[model samples]
Target: MLILTLVIVQLPQILRQVQEWRYPRCYAAEVEGWAAAYDLDPLLIYSFIHTESSFDPEAESSVGARGLMQMTEETFYWIKSKIAPDEALNFDSLYDPDCSIRFGAYYLKLCLERYGGDIATAAAAYHSGWGTVDALLENGQYTRDGTILAEFPYTQMAHYVQKILERYQCYTELYGS
Candidate 1:
């Protein structure tokens, strides 16, 4: 019991240390700009960034997602042509907070639009791909009432959606609205 109490007390300090060590420039201006461009809530973009990369500009996932937003190389290339046609895209720029946040916000907007702004559906599509989500919905695999029912396949992605939602709630409470 004593050890557990000590660990619980120290966990917040450890998390604070981690946050300070991993602090990347917020890039709020860039995030807001991209959010406006894509008609998304700036707070949602912020929450996504926090959840995806924990504000680590240089973060790279084992699957090769890169930068503050953990964007895939293919996604970066695709968005570069659409949103930054004249600018040459270098993979190294993925570590730039501004560039990464911009691309991520744009991608989230695209997903939101594709999924009709249903956060759960959009999140699931983002994690598991749109085709899978669409097929599940189209074939009545999911209920029309909009609960994340257990009948849905891709348990990993279902959990991912839950995590994102939980993180978003935390971000809202921490940052306000």
Candidate 2:
């Protein structure tokens, strides 16, 4: 049953590709440029977008995050001040894919650096707020390894990390690197 054997071997990869494509990148060029500019992985950005808004550019959280990256207005202003000091910014600008990713990617990069290059920690901070992550580290429940989580204190954040990693793995498997 050579055909059956082939099907069994290929089925998982095909499924993973389909799942990864379930949340396609809406702004590829913006993602590519910002990822490159920030030395971040494109798949990682894609994964965050999928988890944050599922490619919905107009998605807004109850807490007021908006756009493909679900950037908050406060964070948007911070980005404008920190990243592009001279640019005049407004809350509605977060709805723009190009603008949102540019700021979101930079923000993620900052978070990663804050955790000493830990994506999980940075992502945890993103989903659970930086203050919570800081408190977790201060309380000594979570590890600050920077590459892997020694222990994620929050259950919701742990689940968030797992989901993002799964999506990122799927994307990397389907797309090169």
Candidate 3:
């Protein structure tokens, strides 16, 4: 009777913990379509969104980044013009969940392509900027033989990359396609 009572009391907490460890599919259908369209890993996108804004559609950063992916207006417009020339883009629409995830996936794809498929470097570029990361790599700060360093000189960017990768791995392990 005591064991049953304990199990009943603990079940919800254990389930919540398990769900937390599992991959979060907040915008499931939209994220799925966008991930496929962008050729990005769904888990990576999910982890990125989770880290950037904790899936908050109305999220805004101190630096004026907004929405689920925490994208700045400047970056969003650049990507919008580059990718969707015909699609109308309003600066305020970035706060919308759908737009944010789509834009973020596109930006991630661009980063990956710009960094030659080096996810770590691309992530650094995402957190910092391509120009900064490129300069460092060229000067042998973050990259020596063109491989992205796990132990980067910039502490925040390095930690961000490490955490994202770890969360991505966790998502993949817990719920991979």
lDDT of 3 by residue, 1-177 (tens): 999999999998888678765657799777788899999888888988988888889998899998888898899889889877788777778888889889999999888998788778888888888877877877665566764554467879888888788878878766774
lDDT of 3: 0.82
How would you encode candidate 1's per-residue C-alpha lDDT over 1-177 as one tens digit per residue? Answer: 999999999999898667544433277788878878778877687767777787778899888899877888878888898899899777779999888988888888888887667777777766666678767876655756443333456778777788778766755655567
Number of the predicted model whose lDDT against the real structure is largest: 2
* Candidate 3 global TM-score: 0.86
lDDT of 1 at 91: 73
In angstroms, the error of model 3 at 114 is 1.8
* Model 1 lDDT, residue 170, Cα: 59
TM-score for candidate 1 = 0.75
In candidate 2, stretches whose alpha carbon ends up further than 4 angstroms from where it belongs are 1-20, 144-149
Clashing pairs in 1: none
Candidate 2 versus truth, CA RMSD in Å, comes to 3.3
